[model samples]
Target chain A: MSTTTLLLLLVLVGVLTYLYRYAMIGLFASRSLPAWLHALCRHIAPASFAALTASGLFVAGGEVVFAFDTPRPWAALAAVLVAWRTRNVLATIGAGMAALYLLKLLFPT
Target chain B: MVQIPTSAGGEFLAGCRDEAPLLLGVAPFGMIYGIAALAAGVPAWVAQLASAIVFAGAAQLVIVQMLAAGAGFIPIALTSGLLNLRHVLYSASMAEYVRHLPRRWRLLLAYVLTDEAYAVAVLRYQQRHAAAADHAEHTDSGTPAADATADLRHWYFLGAGFTLWAGWQLSTAAGLLFGATIPPEWELDFAVPLTFIALLTLLLRERAGQAAALVAGLGALAFAALPYKLGLVAAIVLGLAAGAWAVRRLGPVR
Candidate 1:
């Protein structure tokens, strides 16, 4: 992309982001949130985070690859297990990395 | 919500302290974005400035990656917008908290908001507000009131947002300057996912949360073939809809 386009992209995202951040806040500046909306909003984080994690773990080079040869799924499994057991961020990260390295060594692809 | 009003400085410091652990994860994640952008052929200056301009780690990375893949500007912008649409929920949730503050403060805080910062800030807001609510309840029952409106809430938010901002900028700069030196084998790209996983784990203390995450992950994987990464957006929407259904079926976890 050209510099002008890159700048345009940035400007577009920047403005939209501010608007997203400002949308409901501005709309209901003084009003209390309806209970239904509040409940729906609560799900947004969990769902979005899960989606992000899945893409990061399962997709590479714009494709979904989940064979045993790839370490991401295996390592992510290890992370999920550790995270489930310990519920600690540091432990989960350390375990996931270690699992990835070990799988890489074993699979070598 | 104390006998004495806590100063804004105190809240700010607390915000800084609470963000310490998240920063540990963000440090590597920011550098990875810097290096990834450069590898994708984004100009070094634009790549680095994108960190501040977009200031959102995931969206910024996606934009650069899409650009490198020869995506059109409209697709790139749309993807970025869709990816970040989640922030609308965050801002809405936080709106009530900072609504009383000035528009200037609200705008800055909104810009500074990120997934990590929101995670920390919301927990603090819920806890602090709940405690104040409890105290106010007592006062309504004839107990003496004790400075119920004394939360330095905005300062706490500022402290958290600004710290993440600084960390992102510094680490991105580090990555751009030294990205060439770092070995490719380290797989720093994984840092962002790992960080998300950690955060997701923490968010899964409830059964409904677990259900939402499971469905969302499966949904994303199932729809991963969609063009322009519309799969991720599908996953988010599906996850949210499923989670709301689960909550309705099982009742709110809280």
Candidate 2:
């Protein structure tokens, strides 16, 4: 994309994103959400996060490969374990990154 | 009558203080975005502008990749918006505490609303509400409304937002300038997935969240071959469906 096009796209994306976030809060202000809707909202973060994380972790070159040789799945497991145990975001990220680099060195895949 | 906090500035500063650790966690991702935007051939000014304009790490990264691949503008913009739609839900959740603020303040707050800020703000609000409830039972009706506490929470959110916004802009600019110097073999790309993993781990602190994450992961894996990022769409739908189902079946936890 040309610079102008990229700039336009960036601005459009920014406005749309800000509106998506802002509109709901603006519209729903001072109104209590129904219990069911509130309950559904609780899932939004986890679900979206999971979708984003999983797509990055397992998909490679438009295919799914679940193999021990790939560092992602294993490193993710390590990260999850550390996170669950310590409930620490930084530690979990560090452990996962460390595992990936170590696996890369040992296996070279 | 409610007594507003005497030190909105101080409260905002303290909120920033609480968010310092999360800011650190987010900075590397911002730096990675900067580097990746440059690698994707976005112009230095455009790349930095994307950070300034979009101010969202994940959506900006997705937009950069799509633009590099020659995706149409409308599709790229829509996808970016869709990816960030979850923020709407966050806003809805956080609206209750900030609803009483003036319209101008609410509008500005909405602009700066983000995942980290929402998380910290809601937690603080809940804490304040609980304290108020505890005090209400023993106190007489003459006590003032607890607006000061709410003001403090709002200030905290401002600190968090300001810190995040500054870090994001500076890092993107740095990446645009210094990105080409870094070798490809450094595998900085891996950091993106690692960051998400860390975020997911932090999120799955409860059974419903854990279940939703598992469903999303498995769904994404199952539909990984879908074209045009359809797998991602499927993963989101399935994950949310799974989470909603879990809540329906088991009810809210705590």
Candidate 3:
């Protein structure tokens, strides 16, 4: 991409994204939301976080990859288990990295 | 609700403190984006500025990937926009809390909003609401009034958002300067998902939450083929529906 194109791309995406973030915030400030929207909002964290986590673990380069040779799945499993059991962020990340290294050593691929 | 002892400055400090640990994951994630942007042949200056210009990790990465693939500008822009559409949901969710603030404050906060910041800030808000509810119950009022802390909560939001912003800029610069020296073996990028997992775990205190998460995860896989990354959006919708259904099936939580 040329510098002009790149700059334009950056500006366009940036402005569009800002609009999306600001739409509800700026427009709905004075209006009261319906009960159903509030209910959906309550679950936004769980649903979005879960989707992000799963896609991060399973999808690669726009394709789903779940191979035994890859350590990500196993490492993520360990992280989830650690997270569930301890609810400690550092512990969860530590367990994930440790499991990834261990699996990499065992699988060597 | 109650006479909670917290000022704007105190809440600001609290926000900074809460977001501090997540910066560990954020710094490396920013570095990864910087390195990836350079590797994709994005000019170093553009790459650095993109951190602020685009100000989104996933979307920036997507833009660079498409650039490297020689995709057209329109396609790249569209994909990035679609990928970031999730922020709409976040805006709506946060509308109630910060709505009463001035337009300038709302604009500023919206500009800095990101997935990490939203997760941390929302969790704080929810916890405070829960505590206020508990206090009301103990007093036998059975009525949780409007949040009294709303006045200073934006300070907390600002504190968290600005901290993340600074971390992202520095990390992106570091990656542009020295990221190549970092080896792929380190796998620092995995920290991003691990952080998400940690946040997900905290959000899953009930069966309805678990159902939402499960459906969202599975739905993302099923819809992975959707163009412009709309699959994530669809998955989230399905997840929320599943959660709402589960809530009705199980009845309300007292």
Candidate number achieving the greatest TM-score relative to the actual structure: 2
Give per-model CA RMSD: 4.9, 4.6, 6.7
The TM-score of the first chain in every model comes to: 0.70, 0.72, 0.66
Taken in order, the candidates have interface RMSDs of: 3.4, 3.1, 4.7
Question: In model 1, what lDDT does residue A75 have?
Answer: 87
Tens digit per residue, CA lDDT, model 1, B39-157: 77778889887887888886886676556545567656755776677777778778767776667887778888788888888888888766767867656632212342565777888
DockQ of each: 0.52, 0.53, 0.48
The DockQ value obtained for model 3 is 0.48
Q: For model 1, what is the alpha-carbon lDDT of residue B78? A: 58
Q: For model 2, how does the per-residue alpha-carbon lDDT over B172-213 read when each residue is reduced to its tens digit?
A: 777666677888666665555666666676777678777887
Candidate 3 chain A: worst-modelled 10 consecutive residues by lDDT = A29-38
Winner on DockQ between 1 and 3 is: 1
Q: Model 1 in CAPRI terms: which quality? A: medium
lDDT of 1 by residue, A1-109 (tens): 7888888789889888888777766755666556776666566667767877777666765677766667878888898899889988778878888998888888785
C-alpha lDDT of residue B214 in model 3: 97
Best by DockQ: 2
